[model samples]
Target: MNYDVFNGDADGIIALLQWRFADPLETQLVTGVKRDIKLVEQVEVQAGDELAIFDVSMEKNMSALEQALAQGAHVFYADHHRSGTIPSHGNLDAHIDLDANTCTALIVDKLLKGRFHTWAITAAYGDNLIAKADELADKAGLDAGQKAQLKELGTLINYNGYGSKVDDLHFHPADLYQALKQYVSPFDAIADNASPYYQLQSAYQQDMNAAQAVPAVHESSKLKLFVLPNNAASRRISGVYGNWLANQNPDSAHAVLTENADGTYTVSLRAPLSNKQGAVAVCGQFSMGGGREAAAGINALSKDDLAAFIDAVETYYA
Candidate 1:
């Protein structure tokens, strides 16, 4: 069997889309919510299987990766998140870069020699590499209007991935991927008024309106924190909301915590855009927290640890 395992986010989906567009494949897709990074284990790998994985942290999925390799599966893995250690196995092909300015789609773009460069730029924008994406956009000769469209398109795709579960999302990642696979160029998707772009834009605006109404739970020069009420909308907007907050105040670290049904919180943290180096470290101090340096998250933070998490972010930025 051939499995395309990817994070449900824009980076993962676009990375895989570029690869598959260049090399058409009839494969089963394995993906989940944006935070479900341990996806490699979800698959029951068989000998001779081929798995193309993207976006999720290799460190979190290392054991499952090893299991797949041991079972004689050929695994192609690519990501930008922290990868503890890479294995040297003939059956495994890994491409990982830890640069905060680059994402998995950008790496795959390099491999594809920019066959789908526009899509890669969109992924970068979606990942919140705004300055880098803008630079690339200028280099690509995209006019101001075009750049704005791509940014909005990328942001909407990314926002669609933030839900706590597939049910919370407007469209399943796999479904979203297939919807987008029809167009090799992101512009084509945007031009099609009857596309996911339009759908997501409408949904995103509504969610953002709700989010903006919630006042900050804590704010300081070092860090600004907001705790959203538990709901589908809050879960669907947490990560992207963190990105929005970080962009709004580039010098202050931002955290968006969404209350869970069980009173725990799902935390999304973004290091100051001016210094995108400590988000992963700050989040790593908590259980179920991990990501790239610019953006990281804790899947479930106890209510009690909320204060500590805030202190950690403040200290890191201070």
Candidate 2:
């Protein structure tokens, strides 16, 4: 069996989309919530299996990756996250770029020589690489209206991936991906009124409205922090709300905390867009926290750690 393991977010799904468009394959997909990074272990590997992995961090999925290589699986891995030392094996094909401005789909775009460049651009937008996506859109000569459409589409798809579990989402990432795979171009999906884009567009507006009503629990020159009440809506809006906050105040670091049932918090941290640095550093001091420099998150932060998390963000950006 061929297994395709990827993050449930736009960058991961679109990364795989570009590959399948370039090299059509019958593969079993393994994906989960945006924070579910240990995807490589989900597949039972056997000799001669083809494994395609994307967007998930290599360091987090190292053991399963090594097992797949040892099991004689031919593995193709691509990502933009920090990867520990890559394994040395002829059966493994690894494509990793740690650049803050780039994402997995753009890496796949390079591999395919831009055969599916527009889709790659959409993924970049979805990953919140706004400036980078704009540059690519300009280079592609996409008109202003077209660029806006792509950004909105990307944001909606990304918004759908924020929930703590699959059930909290508007559409499970796997389902959303399957729903989108029919379109060779994102614009085609937009033209189809029944597409996920339309569904997500409406839903996103509702959740974003609720999130906007939430004022910052902690605000300072270096950082602003918002703690949202626990609910499916809060879970859905947490990360995207953080992204919105970061965009609104490009000079200030931002954190969006969603209260978990256990009284802990799920944290999404974004460094200032103007100076994309230290997010991972700040989050890394906590357990279940790790991500790229521009964006990072803590899957579950105890309530007691709230004060420390805030101070860490302020100190790092100070």
Candidate 3:
């Protein structure tokens, strides 16, 4: 059996899409909400099975990866997250890059020699490597109109992954992947009015309208904090909203907190775009928190620690 395990975000989805597009395969897809990075543990592999993992931290899935290797499964892994230590296993082929500007889709793009270059650029945009994506788009000679199309498509695909659960998402990641696979180029999807691109555009605007209407809960030169009510719209918009906030105030760190059922908060933190450093470090201070330097998140933060988290952000950026 062949299994393709990846995160549900645009980067993960596009990375796998590039691989499957270049080398078509019938495989079982294992994915979940964007935050569910431990997808490798969910698969039951046997000797001789093939596993391809993408955009998920190997550190979080280390034990499951070891189990799969021990069971004789051949695994191909690629990601840009904090991978604590890579295990040496003949059955594992790991391609990981921790560069601040690199993502798994870009890694695959390099390996495939840009066989699906446009799709790779979209993933880069989705991952918030905006300047890098723009550079690549310019190098490819894409016009302003084309670049904007890719950016919106990428952003919408990314926004679709922000929901707290698959139930909150407009389409399951697997379904969205399937829907998008029909297009050899992302522009084709945009050209099709009935495509997921248009659907997501409408949905995203509605959600953003609601999110933008809410004022910031706290603001300062060092950091800006916003607390959102616990609801599907809030959950769906939090991460993208953080991205928006960071871009709007490039010199200040931004945090978007969504109230959780248990009175905790789901936190998304973005370091100042002017200095994309210490976000992962700040988030790492809390349990259920880990991400790249530019963007990080805490899965569940106690309401009691909210003030402390704000203090930490302010201190770090101060």
Instruction: Assess every candidate by TM-score.
Output: 0.99, 0.99, 0.98
Superposition error at 63 for model 2 (Å): 0.7
Please rank every candidate by TM-score, starting with the best: 1, 2, 3
Which portions of model 2 show Cα errors greater than 4 Å?
A: none
Candidate RMSDs in Å, in order, are: 0.7, 0.8, 0.8
Q: Over the full model, what C-alpha lDDT does candidate 2 score relative to the true structure?
A: 0.92
lDDT of 3 by residue, 57-112 (tens): 98889999999999999999999998888999899899999988889999999999
lDDT of 2 by residue, 2-112 (tens): 899989888999999999988988889899888999999899999999999999999999999999999999999999998999999999999999989999999999999
Ranking by lDDT: 1, 2, 3
lDDT of all predictions = 0.93, 0.92, 0.92
Listed per model in order, the count of residue pairs whose N, CA or C atoms clash below 3 Å is: 0, 0, 0
lDDT of 3 at 183: 91
Error of 3 at 160 (Å): 0.7
